[model samples]
Target: MSVLIQYYNDFISRSADPRVKQWVFMDNPLPTLAIIAVYLLLVLKILPLYMKNRKPFNLTRIIRLYNIFQVVACILLIYMYLTAGWIQGEYSIGCAPVDWSNKPNALRMVGTFYWLYCLKGVELVETIFFALRKKFNQISGLHVYHHSSTFFLTWIGCKFVGGGMASVPSMLNSFIHVLMYTYYYMSSLGPEWQKKLRPWKPRLTICQMIQFTILIIHSLSAFHPECDIPKYFMLLYLPNLVLIFKMFYDFYKDSYKSKSASLNHHQREKKIS
Candidate 1:
């Protein structure tokens, strides 16, 4: 245990981003880990038990506000990511390395990324909301896995590689969230709105899959010898991307493709009749 602690301290001093270490929850993994653990405990156990005998809270207004905040926050993150480097072309989308200097753009990238990290934490509230509303079915393995994995991974990214090529995925994910939360906000208006927005659900999943696919490609491109971003980062990140991509693909297939196939078979039977 002592040797492992020594090694961990050495690793952090050698590689963790010094600038972000002072930021809230960026000082160490403990705070972030605690937050995630609490989220899991509350949403998966405590809240469910608490609500077992109570009526589900009607959080319609709260949901609308949450969705609106998500949309706005995501849009702002996209712009922040752009100004940090991508907009002025200071960073390469293909294989940009982390800038460790105290330069303005570098610091900006770190700031933007840290906020992105915070946003991932904020997203856990969605699951909490689900639990509060007693929408247990919405809290599927895929849903929880996606939320938790992204939160954890983004923390690692901020701690070690706070910017550069990784920023591409952050920006793209924010863009997708803007679209996603917009749909949520509209659907939260009423049953009629949900009916109208229902058709777009599969499209949202496809967009998520596309984002994951792009991240996989982006992670692969980091293997170039000239790119200073550590190869180990890709090693850690790429496999997660592949796993998430596969999960999303499975979800799309199970949710949309099979339904379409079944509908087609029904139409064919009707014609035969």
Candidate 2:
């Protein structure tokens, strides 16, 4: 383990810019991981055990506010990314390498990247809300894993490759999340509207799968001999995205198929009667 840490330190030191130290939490990785660890523990173990015999708390107002906040934050980040370098006049469509120097635009982009990481942490509340509401069944492995992996993954991107090609996926994901949070925001309205919004939820997952597919391709393109995007960052992002895609797709298939089958069985029984 010490040998592995030494290797990662050597690589990150050489691969990352000195300017990375300027960002909050960039100098120390452990605290971020620890926060995520505590989050997982609370959601999976401590909270559930505590909430077991209690009445579920209604988090209607809080959840709705959270959804709106995420959407607004994502929109702000998207706009900043476009102006900072992601737009046509500013950055190439192919790949943008890390801005090792701390120019103003680079600093803004880096700050937004950090903000995105923090937002991922805040999004963990989604699962916690479920636990609070006693929707424990919704807190599946995929749900927990997705929330867990994103914090570390985005931190890696910011710490090592802040204002570069990786931000593309970050931007794309923000766009999807705008719609996603919008769905959640509407669903938080009430059961009547929530049922109306259920049809849109699957579309959100499909969008997520598509985002992962594009992200995998984008990360792989960095490996082209001409591109300088770090293999280390790609190493962190690509495999995890592939796993995410599979998990989401499998859940979608199983869910949709079961619903269809049950509906068909019920219809056939009605016809028989």
Among the numbered candidates, top TM-score falls to 1
Q: For model 1, give the 10-residue run with minimal summed lDDT.
A: 225-234
Alpha-carbon shift of residue 31 in model 2 (angstroms): 0.6
Error of 1 at 206 (Å): 0.8
RMSD of 1: 1.2
> Which candidate has the top score in lDDT?
1
What lDDT score belongs to each candidate, Candidate 1 first? Answer: 0.89, 0.85
Task: Write model 2 residue lDDT over 123-160, tens digit each, in one string.
Answer: 88889899999999899999999998998888887788
Going through the candidates in the order shown, the clash numbers are 0, 0
